[model samples]
Target chain A: MLELLIVSTLNGVLFGMLLFLMASGLTLIFSMMGVLNFAHASFYMLGAFFGFQISRWVGFWPALVVGPVLVGAIGAVVERFGLRNVHRHGHVPELLFTFGLAFVIEEVVQMIWGKSPVDFRVPEVLDFPAFTIFATNYPAYKLFMLLISIGIFVALFAVLTKTRIGLIVQASLTHPNMVAHLGHNVPLVFMLVFGLGSALAAIAGVIAGPALVTQSNMAALLGPILFVVVVVGGLGSLSGAFVASLLIGLLQTFAVSVNVSLADVFAVFGFTPGPDSMLDDLWRVTVAQIAPILPYLLLVLVLILKPSGLMGTRET
Target chain B: MKTTYVRGLAVAAALSLCSAASAQESIKIGYVDPLSGGGASIGEIGLKTFQFIAELQNAKGGVLGKKIEFVPYDNKLNPQESIVQVQKAIDAGIRIITQGNGSGAAAAITEFVAKYNERNPGKEVIYLNYAAVDPVLTNDKCNYWHFRWDANSEIKMEAITSYMKANASIKKVYLINQDYSFGQSVRADAKKMVSAKRPDVQIVGDELHPLMKITDFAPYIAKIKASGADSVITGNWGQDFALLLKAAADAGLQANWYTFYAGGAGGPTAIKQTGLNHRVFQISEGFANIPHAPAQEFEKALRAKYNVGLFYPRAVNQFGMLFAAMEQTKSADPKKIAAALEGMKFNVFSGGEGFMRKDDHQFFQPMYISSFGERGSGEPLDEEGTGWGWKLVGKIDTGSTMVSTTCKMQRPN
Candidate 1:
């Protein structure tokens, strides 16, 4: 039982951190753009597919560099053409536009890749056990993923706080008109930020692809979870997104690792098991069976607990 | 006399006019699948089978002299995602759509089809369900436009339940399934079968595991151990199966020890993980090992065409059925094809008498049960010749495995 907790928590933390990589970009975009990008995780998926394809021909390290660059360029184009055009119709239109783009991108991906799970292997150089707990070896690649995520976070923090461009961009999110008056090339900055956010998402996808099972539909799965993370962390709050990302990651991770039920809790309270009961299934419950519902449950709980989310000024 | 002659000539010209029929344009078939999402592996196999059929048809110059193109939409196995794809297929002028794999997605599409039919009386988009196993699709809630190609719940479970009664000694039974339409049907059918045939087998415990994201199973394993059932039966697929099996193994749930899992893992993913030839007891479909010319030929061509063990030959179910239908009809006309497919005993060049029961259009065929061996405990299932883990356990006939549901709906022969 102790082994289950330690392993599940550790793995959960790792998984959560990977999710943070994707969620961070989404949060960043929301903070800067003042509108939610529903397609954010799709970019992450694109990153994984791109990384897989490039690595297939060029190798892993090259994909690390090339995948993000390509995806970022595409993101820039999408913002300039797709989002900018739809922006005129209002926020609703903008949201719908990105949503439509997500579906179209999925089809395009199928057409190009031929609908199969690609083999996104961890680079041979980094292939080793990070450490083993309870005779189960933790892969080195996962540890590397943790390191990369932390490194990105540090870099993001340094840029956002320490640089003049970063300061201007941060100011523009709140005072865009003023920033434009100050001759800061605000539109160009927005385009660049959106591009960079997408690139970050892609980079996360590339790194996490091998570990998380690199199938094309992986994007759709991540999209909702990332949305939950953003919403739970507070919309447009980067720090909030970060916390929520980890929280969700750990919540599901730990949820599936241990077994707890109403019946078990009831048993402690002197409730005897009934032979014919809907809760009979509950009596035989385990953490794994309930894992799929944890995110939704968390979403509901967070909504009830903090309507404005963990750190947001906005409530919807 | 001259005026009469001219009037007669005009009447003859009018009477001799041709029917003025138009040339047949290519039939655009839309397919919404999880080509890139969690179900991409499945979509991949389905795609390959589709491509083989497409190529073969094109080589022979298409059906009814019109080409068939499958316009694929990647719905990623999400219901909402499929809604968009289905609409897109409609917008793109596709009159026929085929989908399956995600029951929620299928449910959503079926509902849409029901509304669409009511709105448009003259034209209806035909829905072909290949892999979605929800019983609701065929029930009273069924849509006029939808038809499933796979076995329904009662039929599929009856196959397993009847087999267990006749062969296995294990009197005890436990039920485990995912919490979904397909899972519910599996359990419902299991309950029906056990009560009717093996009443002596005590029903110990039944459980529902969630879909997709189950990563651990120790607690469930402990509970199952306590259930004291001699056999366990389940209907689970995707990552759930992989995780469950691994978890069961970790918790020392030995093979065929306390469980007989029907559906899913004994499928494509299972075949890919290990060679079926090498396990102590293996469950597989009839297509994988039947030594027929067509089966052998398909195996040879498929193996030579792609990476070994990337996909299983069972993917050919759709193509096999489709080709047989086309051959009988020799046309892309829906009415003719539907008439031909109903009550059709089509020989899928692979093996087994693949039957398209006139009732619900579900194909009932015999499946295989094999005994797989390995080098030792924990070794992968072998796939080399007879040495591979899987052995022939004889065929389960369509008559014994699944009864035709044509009686439920009367479509005239």
Candidate 2:
């Protein structure tokens, strides 16, 4: 039991950290723009496919740098054209624009990349086990994913806290009108933040692509979870986003790691189900059996228990 | 000399017309699937196989002296959107369609294609299924316009049960399936198989999950762990199959034996999952690890073009059957093609070549049982460590004869 818990928790932590990489960028954009980027996950998908394509021509390192850069540029263009046009309609409009953009992006990707899962492989250098527990070896690539998230987190903290541009960005987040009056290029700042946020998402995509099974829906699959993370952490708080992401990630990872059915609970109480009972299948429900639903359950619970979220300063 | 040469050439050309005259007609076919999703591996291989055959046919001077053109589109497993693509192909006058996708989407096309054939009998929209295995496709729900390139759900289960009876000591059966039509039907088959073959075998657990939404299996794994089942039967395919093996191993739900009817069950993904957990025989149709000489050559040509090999046996099975249908029908005429395919018997060159059951339009192919070898110790070389390699075992035919569950069904002549 202890071994299982230890392994599950470790796997959860690693998965949580990976989720943080994807969430941090989203939170930053949300805090700055006041409107959630519904297509943030789509950028992540772009990063993966772009990186996979780039690697074929120029190899892995170049893809590691180029993939995110390309995705960031696309994100900036999308913000300037797609989102800007829709910004006038209000927050819902902006959100709806991104949603439509997501569908369009999915189609465009299929057109360019063709329909097929690229046989993506992590570079040979990072291809060994980083750690092992209970006879199970954890791959170096996943460990690298955890490290990259942490590294990005640190870099983001440094940029946000130590730089002059950081001060202007923070000022804009608090008072966009005031920052605009102070001769700040608010739109440029918005573009930069959006680009940076998208680039961060792309980086996460590059790392997770080989691990999570890359496909057209990779972004859409992560969309709801990332949204849930942002909402659960409190829409406007970075710390809240971080906490929520890790929490949800770990919750899901662990939930799927172990299972025990409801029948066990019934059996303990000396309740035996008859063969014809509709509850026959239920007598065999397990926590691990329901792993897929755990994150949403956590989201609902958080929503009910703390409307402001763990570290939320703003309310939606 | 020039006059004599000209006369000789003219006489030789006139003499070339012989006893068996080759038929002629140009036809266009369309291929659709989520070629870029988690299931892309199957779709991609199927496409390559399609191309190889198309190329082979074209090189021999095209189908009916009019080259066959196969234009493929990506559906990405979206149903409503897939219908749009199919309609587009239909509008462009594409008569024959080959599709391998989720059952829901396949069923949607069935109604559309039937109507398509009815309205435009001049260009009958005949469907050749390569991957969708819903029994309703060839059973009571079957339409005369559509024919399956792959086996039905009941046929695959028959192979599994028949192989198990001769192969292992499966006493207790625990079924874990993705919750849907195919999953439910697979569970039903297993239940029936147990009752029919080994009534003494207790069914300890039966579980279901929504398709493509399964994230964890610990609770189910824990139940199965406690169930003391001797073996497991499932319809988990692709990513679900891969994830389940990891979950079972992680949750320690090891059975004496396990059986599944999936493209990935005996493919690379299963091999990867088995590496993480334990040894497993990924039950597959067709017993060959790599198919015969013609199939191996086809695989080489395919890998050269697509940069990947066929992971699912059905990818090749469906390709071989459809290509064979097109080659012999020789005429791209929809009615003629349908006529040729009905009661079609051709050597598939991929081990035992099975005939398409005329009554039900199901392929009566043999199955392959490939056991996944354990993942070697030490750190995985990148994602390759998760690689699952399958080892081949005995081959058996599931009695390719599909007994029609419906009395109303009849063979198309």
Candidate 3:
């Protein structure tokens, strides 16, 4: 039991860190632009494919740096040319544009990479098991993921809270017009923030690619869950996103480990369903079976009970 | 008045001749499958294979003097979309429909085609399935209009379990499959067969995950390790299969995998990355390394033409049977072709006889169990540039692999 607990918790933490890496960028983008960039996860996919291609030419380490930078540049150009023009038409158009852009990006990726998983393997240096807990081996690549996510979090926190650019960014979130009046290049700042947010997502993608499968559908797989983290963590709060990511990760992992079913729950109430009963599906439902949907279930409850989310100051 | 009557009869005769000539020019077969989205990689390959065979048949003076024309329809792997595509195919005067990527889509098409044939009397169409392997499609839900070329999941599992029973090294086994009808069937069949055949072997873990939805299989791999399973039997195809193998490789897990599709798209790449040599195994109707000159020549020509390997030989088998039936009946009418196909026995490319069971419309042929390893001399094809080809390890003859079906196919008189 202790071993199961320890292993599940570690897995949860590792998964949470990856989720936070994705959610942080999404929350930042939303807070600054007041527009949900649905294409955010697609950019992460771009990072993985680009990183895979670059890794083939120059190796993994260099690809890790160059892939995100290239993605960030593309994000900046899109913000300047695509989003800026659509921003005048209001938030709905911007959101739709980003949503459509996600589809286009996926189609383009398919066209170039084909609709199959790529052979993105972990580097030889980090391919061995880092440690064993309860006879379960943890790969060094997972440890690398944890370390990179932590480093990103610390750097992001330090830059946002302690630096001059951080102060300007924080102020612009609340008072963009006032910052512009004070002689700041507000549009340039917006472009920079968007680019940075995308770079962060790209970093997550590059690190997670080998661990997860690098396929064309990676974006669609992770995109909704990342949004769940952002919303459940309180729409625009980094701390909220972090907390939500960890909560969801642990909840799902622990849930999967537990084999309790609705039938078990109903038995406590002295209810037994017949073989041909209409409620068979309900009785058959297990905690492990529904673990994938728990995040969404939580989202709905959170929206109903706490509209401002767990950490947001603004009304959602 | 006599001159006018003569002219009118001449015009009517010419019009009727033109209509008959146009109809005889082509025998349209509707190719409905995922031509886009996640299933497109396999779907595109299937489409190309059918196109190649159709061209070959046309070059050989066509079937019944009518050129085989395949009309492509993209379903995007959706069942409802497949129904719509089938309707469009029926509207376009296609009497034969073929699809084989997703069992769900195939099931929907099979059911729809059966109902459409029943309702629209003379406008009947036949559904030829090349790859959907859910056993119930042949057993309880089999229809007269539907025929499956690939062996069902139950038959494959029976062969695998028998192989396991013979090999005493397989002490503890694990079952991991996608959480769908096909996957569920695979798990159930594996458990039953393993229990019946090798009662001494312990099943340590059984896990089912959503089809193509899993991104990271590390957690699942961790569980498999904890279970200490010596082997795993999985029916996951496409990205799910690729990703599971990749995760196992990353974790350095050393259990042999008995799979339905270990040589699927991206599978060879994952196998090479793991460097497992021959630990990965797959059971299929045919593979590229089968020692037959004509089969080898056909595979080479396909690669030269399409730049893709022959992943599913069942597609070719399906076309070959259809062409033979067309020639036997000497007609393009679906009913005549269907009657000709029933109880058909023909030679397979792998130097064995294949028989189509009239009772359930299931085709049976020699099934090969191949292993992934270094490409030996004379092996021409390998997946994903792995240079590690799939070599045939075991063969189950058509008679040994046959299973009794519960199909109550209702024929139109």
Which candidate number maximizes lDDT?
3
List of clashing residue pairs for candidate 3: none
> A1-316, model 1: which lDDT tens digit per residue?
5655666666667777787888877877787766789888788889999999999999999999999999999999998888878877888988888888888887787678765666676799876666766554455776798889889888887898899988997898878899999988887888888899999999998998866656556777678888888888888777887788788877876665455676777789998788798778768566556776778778888899897789877884
lDDT of 2 by residue, A1-316 (tens): 5555665566677667767877888988898768888889999899889888888889888998999998999888887877777777888988888888889888888788765556666788876667655545556776787788888888887888899988998888889999999999998898888888899899988887766656677777788898888888888677777888778877776665454777777778998788689978776666756776777887788788887777888776
Error of model 2, residue A60, in angstroms: 5.1
Provide the overall lDDT of each model, using Cα atoms, as 2-decimal numbers.
0.68, 0.70, 0.87
Candidate 3 — which residues are off by over 4 angstroms?
A: A1-7, A53-62, A111-114, A118-137, A265-274, B1-26, B374-383
Cα displacement (angstroms), candidate 2, residue A17, comes to 2.5
Give lDDT tens digits, candidate 1, residues B1-413: 99999999988776555212223556677888877645665665566666666666777887667676778898878889888998899887676778877778888997887677567654566677877777777765465456676666666566566667774576677777777778877777888888788888787766776655443444454455555565677766655564455445434443242122222332333333323222223233443345566665665665456533313343356555555666677755544555665676756454667776555666666655545444343323334232343345556666775653423553323
CA deviation > 4 Å runs, candidate 2: A50-112, A154-168, A178-191, A254-310, B1-25, B61-65, B79-83, B114-124, B162-177, B191-234, B238-344, B351-353, B371-392, B398-404, B410-413
Give TM-scores of the second chain, every candidate.
0.77, 0.79, 0.93
| TM-scores of chain A across candidates | 0.95, 0.93, 0.98
| Predictions' DockQ, in order | 0.26, 0.23, 0.38
Model 2 global lDDT (CA atoms, 0 to 1): 0.70
lDDT of 3 at B10: 99
What C-alpha RMSD separates each model from the true structure? Answer: 7.4, 8.5, 3.5
Identify the superior model by DockQ, candidate 1 or candidate 2.
1
TM-score of each: 0.69, 0.76, 0.91
Give the Cα error of residue B162 in candidate 2, in Å.
4.1
lDDT of 3 by residue, A1-316 (tens): 6766777788889889999988998898899889789999999999999999999999999999999999999999999999999999999999999999999999999899887666787899998889877666677889999999999999998999999999999889889999999999989999998998888889998999988878788899889988888888998899999999999888877776666788888889999788799988778766766778888999899889898789987767
| Two-chain DockQ for model 1 | 0.26
